[model samples]
Target: MNRFAGRVVAITGTGDGQGRVAARRFAAEGALVVGADLDAAAAALTEKLVRDDGREMLSVAGVDLTDEADVVRFVGAAADRHGRIDLLYNNAAAARLGDVTHTSEADFDFTFRGVARIPWLLTKHAVPHLRAGTDPAIVNTASVSGIVGAGMVGNAPLLAAYGAAKAAVIRLSQICAVELAASGIRVNCISPGLIDTPAVAGILGTGVDDRLRGWHEEQTLVGRIGTPDDVVSAAMFLLSSDASYITGHNLVVDGGWVASGGAGRPHRDVVEALEASLAAGLRY
Candidate 1:
């Protein structure tokens, strides 16, 4: 499609999952991609995929996004190489599975440093170069958890921190969208729901794939889970001219899970109980 032809894109957390998928999708569509990640090996893999697919790309040194100097250097090098930055995908994050009471200070700090603070820092450093490019846009990866409370009855602590951090990302993107609108830059966010990614695998423990399959059927109204490609597709649309009028929008791609009115079906016990209550006419 080449929607991104002649464009320069810098994506963080391209090691795997959503970031890697986004890098690949953009590169395939004719964008010059700079893949950055904490895992050098995974970044290289993405770079190779881009090259093998006959796409324009460069594999850069990993940046410790929490480190201010490191982020500056990474963005500076990308801009220096590309002469300008057209797109910035702030897609990196860290996760810890603990409840509020069980989560430690270190866990909270780590999540904020990697997910919250890094995105802000990246935007701050990349804005100058983005301002000089064609159709500049920033796509942040928030989550369904960020939009609403995660239904993690057992893993409350970990989900709490993760959800809170993602909510902050959503709000931050909105503020950036407003502040940067006059500069011809668009800021948007993608809030994914239970996509099949490495991070989700970690959360499911053993038999993760099977668990995910079951979860998809149960939670999503579409009767299936999502893949990284689903998210990448959303990102591509938001970054393209097709979404010129969209900003400060948190698009949820959860297979109708969020829109369902809880009317799919009721369990046998609930149906039987309801029928009995109706038959007895015990209601007030």
Candidate 2:
């Protein structure tokens, strides 16, 4: 469990959800953690969680990852604090839901920058220090949305831009992996399915229809939605030496959603329609 002992990890979007959980996990595993988020209070809360567990962590609030200068400062601070950067987790994201027809330029831009550009900026700045560190790795957060847009349609029809942005991230990770491998730095990504994080709850909102949740759970082969911990565990593995030979890989941690086709009732409708046609004895 001390695989990350003495390592320095810099992660983004640590205010809540996946980022917060990642910070705590890395810190718990003996890494010196640095986390950044626009939500000052939430970032501070993540720091407190680490401190409460008797771990060392630095939380930077009001960090706009899209800003090159801000990202430079964040990465610079982490390297300066620990004298090297051992791992970088690009866990921050901005999601605006809308299909192409309804998606505005603003929404597409936000989603693209948050999911793709920000990680590139961070990696650009962190590469030098990571190149010098031990067992260095970068883990970016992608989504099943990037691989397939089928499952979330019923609940979030506006995820076209989000899915596209995530797909870009997967490509980015592969590029970085190949480019950095010679320097002993590994780059990879994790694609999570409908994880039940605080962010999800807030997005779904209180009193919102439960059908969305039901649909996701039913489609997943595990028979349930994923959790932040589920994702954090996969991320930790990718960052660990056990995966030393792995790079340029997109690990799907979706509880078999992608693997099993994630078929739900809507898909079954085709079968029902076919059966009804057969009963009419007019099938072509």
Candidate 3:
């Protein structure tokens, strides 16, 4: 509690979901939060929510993470206001559900541009400022798909490009951690499973809450899926001094999905149906 007291945090993709929740959690723990996102309106909404809860926050212009100028400006503005940024939550990402062959070049570019490139850019710019701060840390949100194959969901191709990009993020964070250790900047990553977020709704083409509920109960092994708070908790731990010795670590916050190690293995009936479907060429 109050681990982040008097700290300053900058979080990208703070418009909704994990980013928004992270901002609120930091603020509640006495951190001054700067929320940034591509959607200006959504960022404003998040800002209001934090403010409504009597927390300190600042909303900045939405930055295209792929753009160097935008990232520089966002990082500069945050440092100018807060004096220093203690934590950087690189949580913005886009999802594309398709096989490697089926995924388009544009999809790959868009996903990496928003998720990987932006976070890398922000890290580059935020380094000096973070180095000047007290207990500086960076928390990147990767995914379980980055570490393991995503299972089939109604014959849909799992997130191919998205998973690859997130894997890169994990490696990037690890490299940063090793390189920046001398500078007193800790870099860590969190790999989440299925979290109930607006982006999930878009990917699944279903109502957010309904899809989340179903996935929580049936798909995840923990009898429920993750929430933004689950991720925020991991992030907070990395950013806090409690994890001072922890660096270059990838924390998986999935609901026992990755731990189970039985993701790609199908049940007997499911395997029979899949074989039958394949023999019939119905899958193709």
Highest lDDT model number:
2
In TM-score terms, which candidate is top? Answer: 2
Candidate 3 runs further than 4 Å off: 151-155, 202-216, 262-284
Cα RMSD for predicted model 2:
3.3
TM-score of each: 0.90, 0.90, 0.87
Off by over 4 Å in 2: 153-156, 202-206, 264-284
Candidate 3, RMSD to the unseen true structure: 6.3
Assess the local accuracy of residue 83 in candidate 2 as a C-alpha lDDT between 0 and 100.
89
lDDT (Cα, tens digit) per residue for candidate 2, span 12-38: 999999898899889988988889998
Q: Rate the local accuracy (lDDT) of all candidates.
A: 0.82, 0.87, 0.82
How many clashes does each candidate structure show, in the order listed?
A: 5, 1, 0
Worst 10-residue lDDT window, candidate 2? 198-207
Clashing pairs in 2: 98-158
